[model samples]
Structures are given as C-alpha cells and as structure tokens.
Target: MNRLVPLAVVLGLTTASCSGGHGAGSFLPSGAPGAGSAAPASAGARTTRSTAVAAPPAGWATTATQAVSLKSATDLGALDATKPVTVRLGLQLHNVDQLKSAVQSRAVLSPGQIQSAYAPTASEVAQVTNYLQSQGLTSIAAEPNGLMVSATGSAAQIAKAFDTTLHAFTVNGVSAYANTAPAYVPTALNGIVVAVLGLNNVQAFATSPHRGGQAVNHASPADSAPAPQPESPCALSSVFIVGLPSPQPIPTPEAYTTGCPRNYTPSDYWRAYDVGSTSGAGRTPIAIMAEGNVSSSIADFRVNEQGDGLPEVPVVVKQVGVASPDTAGADEWTLDMTASTGMARRVSTIYLYATTSMTDSDIALMYNRWVTDDLAPIGNSSFGGCEAFPYLDGSMLVDDEIMLMGAAQGQTMFASTGDTGSFCSVGNPNGVPGGAPLVEYPAASPYVVAVGGTTLWSQYDGTYAGESAWNAGGGGLSQFEYSPFWQSGIQPVGTTATGQSFRGTPDIAMDGDLQTGMIVYIASAGGWTTIGGTSLSSPLAAGVWARMLQNHPGLGFAAPQLYHTFAMSNPGTKLLGPPPTINVGPFHDVVSGSNGAFAATPGYDYTTGLGSLDVAALNAVIGQ
Candidate 1:
C-alpha cells in the first residue's frame, strides 16, 4: 500500500470525506439558538430568527443608487447594457441581517425578506414602476420577482439614491424590505434591477400586525464598515497529487476502506491542516457546488471517525432540478451531475438544470446556485454550456457575475479547462465526433485559474511519477482578449499580440486520469460509488486552496502572485532577485508527457504551463 500523502504528517489532522454524508460528518449544525442570535418575528419579514435559520442573500446588482434586492434582477454592469440588458431573479435569502451584519453599516435589508418571505405586492410594483416612469426610467419589466428598470441616467447618481432608501427604511423595530448592499453590485450598463429590501423582508400577513413598532436604524453605520487594512497577498503553488490506490478489479466491499491499500482506502481524502494560530482563530469556510445531498454522508464520517470534528458550519442546500420547490430556476441535477465532487467542510450543494423555459438570456440565475453567508472559496463548475465559437453568449456573463466577482471578492475559483485535448477540433472518442477545437467557456474566463488534467504512474515500490499531460488535457490560443497581466509568459503559437495567439489556457494541472484517479464515493444516484474526472481534480484543488487561505488570512487574489513569483523570473534569476526567491523554490517543473497532439515539451508547453505548485513554496509566495 502507498503511504498516506504528507498532508497527514504536516497537518496532523486527517479530514476524510465519503460519497454521501456531510464532510465534517456527525458534526452538522443542529440549528440550535446561540446567545446573540435573534428569532424571526414573522415568516416573510426580516427577523432575528430568520437570519439564523438560512443562508444570507447576495448583494444588490445595481449602480450607486439604482441597485435592487437580491431577489429583484441580475447585475447588468458586467455587460454593457448600453448595448442591451437582460433581467432575472435568483437565490433564496434565509437571513437578511446575518448577511448585513457581515457588512454592518451597509446593511440594506433583512435576510428573510431577500429569500422572498416578503416579495412586493402587485400594487407595490405598480407604485414603484409609476415612480420610475415619472422619473423618466423606461423599458421596465415589473414582475413578481422585482422590477427591472432601465433608463439613460447617470448610474452613479441612480445607485446612490437607491442605496439611500434601501439602508434607511424600517418597520416594527426591524428592517422592512431587505436587499443586498452596493459593494456587491456589479458594473452594469443601462439595465438596473430595482430591489425593494424593506418590503421583501416581510410577508404581507406579518407586515400588517407589526405596523406600529419603533423604527429600526437601517442606514449605513459610520463605523460599521470593515476597517481599512493591508490587502492580503497569496500565490498559486504546485497542485500536489495524492494518488489513490485503484479499487479491486471486481470492486469488493473492502475496496473503499483503510483495510484496502492506500490508493483504494476512503475513496476520497481531504487535506486537513490547522489554519490561523491557536489564538487568532482564523476561520476558513469550504464552499462546495455539487449534486444531491451529502449531509448524511458527512454525519456518518464524523460519528464513525475520531478527528478534529467535522467542518463546523450550516449546510443550506437548495434543489435545482426540474419541478423544484421554486419554478423560476432550472433543474439542478443535470448541472449537479456535472459538478458532483466532495469537500472537507460543511458542504451544501444547490441543484440546477438549464431548461427550455429558461430563455437563452435568462442565464444569470445560474449564479445563485452557491451564494451563501458562510464565506469560503467554492469548488467550481465541471460541465459547461454548449458553444460553437470562441465565445458563448451566456457563458461570459455568468463568469463575470459569479466567478470573476466571487474571486475579486476574495473567493478562489478552480475550473477545468476541458477534457478535449486543446481548443482546436479533434476526433471523437468511443466513435462520437468532437466539435471544432474551441476554448471552453468559463474555463477560458480570465478570472479563474483554468486547471487541466494529467496522468501519473505509481512506481511498484510506491512513489509516483511527476505529472504528465493526460493525453486529453485542453490548451490552445484563446478566442478572447487576454484579461490578466500574468498571461504574458504564455504567448500563443503562431501569432503576435495582435493575432489569435493572444488568448491561452490550462494555467495548471492535477491528476485527472481515470487509471490513476482519486478514490471518491458518490451517494446521489444510490449507494456509495467511486468516481473521478477533471471534475474531482477541481474540487480537490479548491479544498487545498481553502486550507492555504486559512493558513494565510492575509492572502489576496492569486493572479498577481502567479506572475510575480513565476512568469517574471527565469532560469538565471533563481540566484538573483530578492531574498525569498519566488519561482525556483515553489514550482515543480513538469518536464514530461503530452495531451494527445500537443507534446509536453521541456519548459513551458501547451500541456502544462510552468508546471504545478509546491505547497511549501505556495505558502511562501502567499506570505509575500
């Protein structure tokens, strides 16, 4: 049996996850009340109890003044609505204050209302729309979700006015309507989603009974915003591989346990190292985007094992498959099937599926799948929407709103480049034909670190070979303009800055081959079962990144560090540069393998760019 990867030795805690249960296992939050926790006074309106009962809503998607509630519409700023605007409502906010408390002074609405306990009444919509029309706002779609108001006004002025009202209104000693704050709003074009926070926080039945209570203080607090502090720095290290022993040829019962060899045991592994010092108490949230439910699975792991205890947080899961509790969204299973990997934290997977009823433009609702109050880096998407050209209509918008904005807001996004070896067209496997080589959507997104697949060989004695291209890894010139500055080192073949060679992909690699795949059990379809793919690799990387972020609370986004540590310096600089030599120590050069037609030539090749990261080196870079 192969030895357990160094994670156990260094971190001292072995956090293991199975196919079905909550990752931290028996340790699921019981929803018990805490001392400061408040109870919701009514079902629809924002209440202390309401905030604690469910996940908080996301921020408003508007300008300085015109932004709306989380339930209102999509943030069109990511796109130039001066061109065109699309609006849609998504996400269910369980607690408004809990979310607002995180941003204190910027509190706009209660969590309960954002979740729709208090959507606007038909009469209320007419009132708001009439007001907008009087103010010259046109192209309005006033639906049950919220109002979608657009006009040619200064975005800044409109946003400011909107926020003033959202943050000042209150009823019966609680925030009346609850919407997200302005900071969370994106840079939209002419489109704006008018979110009514005060009203959304309550149910009509509840609001009538509490009409005469003391007004709540709903304005942005002078000292409530987070204090100014240094931006945390971080670096991307080599993606270490812990090769799982393959299961029995016939797949026996013992194949998934410690009784089996190192590779076959546990079916999955979660790297567990303590973050923050014993005193400072740094909290690292593990956000997962998967299918079905893993609560039972996690509870089992905690009850059955002896460890630091299962991840401590609430798991708020929303089903997204067709025939959902809510109709506005798509079925989540189809999307979940493509995103079913496990994590070592309190895991909550939102189910979602693209449907015929969902217009091609209504894709923004997809971002609501994993937005929650427990802040943590999320394991990213596995499957992507179909696209024929370099760009997909709905792809970038979602990436901009969710992935880019999420990363900018301090969440790390890990995505799979593609299974097809490179973006150029290729022959189909199993006799099915392959589409023309096109850069995969989202993965090709500039904000995310596009991870590719790799194959590895475990020597008979145990140690594994350095990573090599998985023969199916994706890479190629990009179809879009290069967004990040660090992309300089990766010049696409056969073109200058002005040509097709401008865009590139597969920022890094991990073990993604089925032969040398990971040991994972999935509980969705039925009993425990093993599975692997670039899908597994993405989450594994995300979990590891969570640990790293926990370790370095000061870590900023990883993009800057990638270039500062690796791309900027070359061979000779190893001896020169500053004291903490960036690239030379942290990275492990992948000197072999290939992704089918693309050879993993020495140095930077299309297969694996600058190689994978080293944990220790990564820690050092993040520290810088």
Candidate 2:
C-alpha cells in the first residue's frame, strides 16, 4: 500500500494533525438541528425526516442547514456586507422512500413519471421562492423538479435572510467565502428546504485529467508530423512503465509507443477492451457534465472524429447557469467527449451540460439540468473534490437527490473516483500523501457509478494482456456516506467515523495511468496530448454503458445490476486472478497492484474496484 506523507512534509503546515470530520469549529452553528443521519431503514429504503425549528421568543424559529462544513478551511475575515452573493435553496424531495423503492426494484420510469411521483410539490417551490423574494433576493429560479431554488442577493441581505454571516477564507489557496454560522430556515419551511448552497464559494470540483508530458503546438507542420515509430515491441518495452517498480521491466506494446510519451488511441481501447462492433448505435444519448464555454472543445472533438474515420456525433451544449467565456477546462471537457465517443465509435447525441463554474452550487445545477433534460441515459462527470468538501457544503445531499431522480428515470451517471491515490488532494492537485484517506464525492455517492483507474497492459495488436490498479487511482471507503443497499454484501467490511459501513469506490475502472493515457485533441492547448486519470476512465465507462443501453435499453441503475451480474457469474465470490487466462465474468478482475492505503485483491478491493471492463462481455450480460 502507498504510504501517506506527513502533513508538514506535504503542505509545510505547522499543524501537527488534520481533522477530517466536523468538529466544534464546524460551520454549522451550535445546537443547529435537522440533518439526515439515519441510514436507510432497510435494504433499498430511503427515509426523510424534517428538522424541528427551535422555538424562540417572538421570532420565527430556525433550523440549521444539514449540509455545511468548514473542515479544512482557514478563516480570513468577514466579507463586506455589501458584497453580492448567490445561493440555492435545496427543497426536500417528495416521496423519497417511494423513489428509492422504485429505483431499487429496477422499474424504469420516464422523467415525467419520476417528476409526477417524486418531485417536490409546486407549493413547496413557491414557499421557498416567496421567502427568497421577500428577503430582497433577485433572479430567483426553481428547477423543474422544485428541488433547487437559486437566487442572488447582497451579503447583508443573505445574512439577514438565512440567519448566518458570510465570511472570507483561504481554503487550500483558493479565495473562498462561506457562512460563518449555520444557515437557518424558517420553521414554516422545515421540510420544504433542505440545504442552503452557495453560501460558500469554494470550488469543490477539479478536473481529474493527468497529463503525461508537455503538449506540442500542433499548429506547425513539423509538430503535427508523426514521430518515428518503435522498430519492434521489444524496443517499445524500453519505455518506463508507470505504477511498476523499476527492474520489473514488462513487455510494452507497440501501440503504446505510437504517440509521444505513449498515448493510446480510441482504436486501441476498443480492441483492448474487446468492444467488438458495439458503437452505441440506437442508444440513448450521453451527457458530459462540464463548465464554461466548450465551443473550442467541441471543434477539437470534430477534428479528432474526422481523423479517426468516425462519424461526427451530434453535439448539444446546454448552459446550466450564467454563461461565462472561461475555457480553462476545455481540455478536460474535450477529453471527456472524445474518449467516450471514441469508445462507443458512434453515438446518437452528446449533450454537454456546461455550467458557469466548478463551484458546488453550479455543479449541482449542472447535474439538475442533466437529470431534468433526460436527454441522456448515461452521463459522465470527469471532475470531483474530496468527499468531505461536498458533504460539508451540501452538494452531496443536493446532487445525490438529483442523481436519485436520474436513477429512477433509468439514467446512469459515471463519475471519476479522482486521480489521487487513496488520499484526497489537499491544496495540491497531484494529491498529497500522508493526509487522511478519503474518496472523491459523486463517486462516493451511491447514486452514481464510481470509475477508477488501472495501468493496462495490452498486446501489440491491442488485445488485452493484463492490468493492475493504477498507483494514483482514487479508491477507499467514504468518510461520510453509508454503504448503499446494493453494496451490502459485496463492499469490504469497513465503518466510517460515524460507525456505519461506508460506501467503497470505485465500482469500476478503466485504463487511466498517465503512461498509457488517451490521445486527445485540445484546441485551446493547440494540439494533441496524452492524458489519463480517472477522468478518462469515467467517460470510457460511460461510453461502454451507452453501448450496453443500446443492447438493453430498459436497464436501470447500473450499480445494482452490475453487482448482481457479477454475483451471478462468479458464484461464491470466487477470487479472480490476472486476465488473459482467467474467464472472470464481465469484468477483467485486477488482482495486482495497490493505490496507497488499499491493494488490488482478488475481488472488490479499494484500489481497482471490480477491476476494469470487458466491454463485449459486459454488454452481453449487463441487463441479465
């Protein structure tokens, strides 16, 4: 297992220890109540409870917001009261228990059906909207499902309205703002309002792509020209293999040496994973959760498709919030689109849900749009933060609700478990070892499929040789979320700080080592580059899932089905060995390598959860 670096060694902090859970200095105000704590009453059951507003003399009783945490933040000072702020009032879902049951039963419901049965009532939406309007907030809009109400107001107005004070802080070098005290809601809206988001402006999501080397500007003919190819597979084997110790020299495939720094092409992935001829034809659309303007990324994708001799998939960009010209994440978005389509070969439509930023609030809105649009049965989120961050800020709660809705509608979301090893990145993008072991959010959420990473070893012809868990692949038990019902019997025995069996990530993995990364076109970056991380793994999973949906359009909530399929195929939970000879079910169960605190075991280890995919095999039995 990889070891953690001391906090002082990693962050140069004088602090001797790091706290991973909510403590006395938590953002939630003292004695604040009304947060969901109890797990599902039974297998696949969801329970909803309202916070009782505290009775105060001659004033409206208030309850603390359930989703608010200030775990790793350092307070700077109070924000100027005149500063403007925007927040989303997350409304409670109606009939959540029924929704959970419907999803667990694998009943495929349409978006309309889900909304009709589980969306919050119109009155609930109005109650929150009216309250926000009365508080002098503007630009208020409630999502179609009435689960999230967004509004903008002055910091002073917000503080007065929510009974909390906004304060500035430096969270891991990012300038941010958060509520110094727990946000409160009137007693009247006890169950109507679940969370107050955007009170904190810390960016909770980061792109998971990891670059192998500096990209060349493909604008020049010399740069665009292909480099000399390796003479033979033996010659290619000289290149250092990632995640393996030196002197453990393994046979590297010629395909891996085709690009500078060794990047694999879409064709290579198709062959390696035995995708066969499945191209997601006649499949429901796929969605990519992205931020900012992605026009350049889309253009780059077209260039790649043309070069690969693949048909250009129809693309749609849905702006989820205030539009911004930021293309900072263009490469990440491009990777997601290209890698997914590259896997499927052909897709009906690719919807990009572009939000204004990666903030928790915007990301939540982006997810809400995808759930509501119902344009795609499979969606990919190539970005995530440490699970604790989202859990504290309430995005986990709000987004989980949105994902649950997607699950009920037969929509599946695939999220990267993160590029960090077993530990989450703290003030460092590459991840700091020696920090508390934590999983990435959204992936940690039981509602979505967590895609991990692996160092794939393929033959010269792209046939699968074997694979090991990528050293940097994100996996481990979640610190907060309880193990979902589907994971009851399969997840490794482990309890969270709350003493509940927490969820384990990731449910699946794909080629993600930077050494064997995907070759993608990034217009903003001026050309082709090799990138990996769970970011690529997730979209790859999504694309493969799209193919499965093409074969079995009625499939619902992939996690449960995947687990059930694995159990059926590998009866008695047999320990699987390395591939090529082992006929391990639908997945190529990885039995070697480790990712920090966890090692790749025969079955369901934290490092490479459920191993990587055997696309053709999975498609054959996914819905069975």
TM-scores, all models, native as reference: 0.49, 0.83
Best by lDDT: 2
- Alpha-carbon lDDT, every model: 0.35, 0.69
User: How good is model 1 by TM-score?
Assistant: 0.49
Candidate 1, position 104, lDDT: 22
Candidate 1 lDDT (Cα, 0 to 1): 0.35
Local lDDT at 608 for model 2: 80
Backbone-clash count (model 2): 4
Q: lDDT tens string, model 1, 247-321?
A: 123132321221111221111232211111221122554443433333443442332121212233333443332
Shift of residue 361 alpha carbon in model 1, Å: 6.2
Candidate 1: segments with Cα more than 4 A from true spot: 1-282, 291-314, 318-363, 368-374, 386-392, 423-436, 458-464, 481-483, 492-501, 523-529, 568-584
RMSD of each: 21.6, 6.9
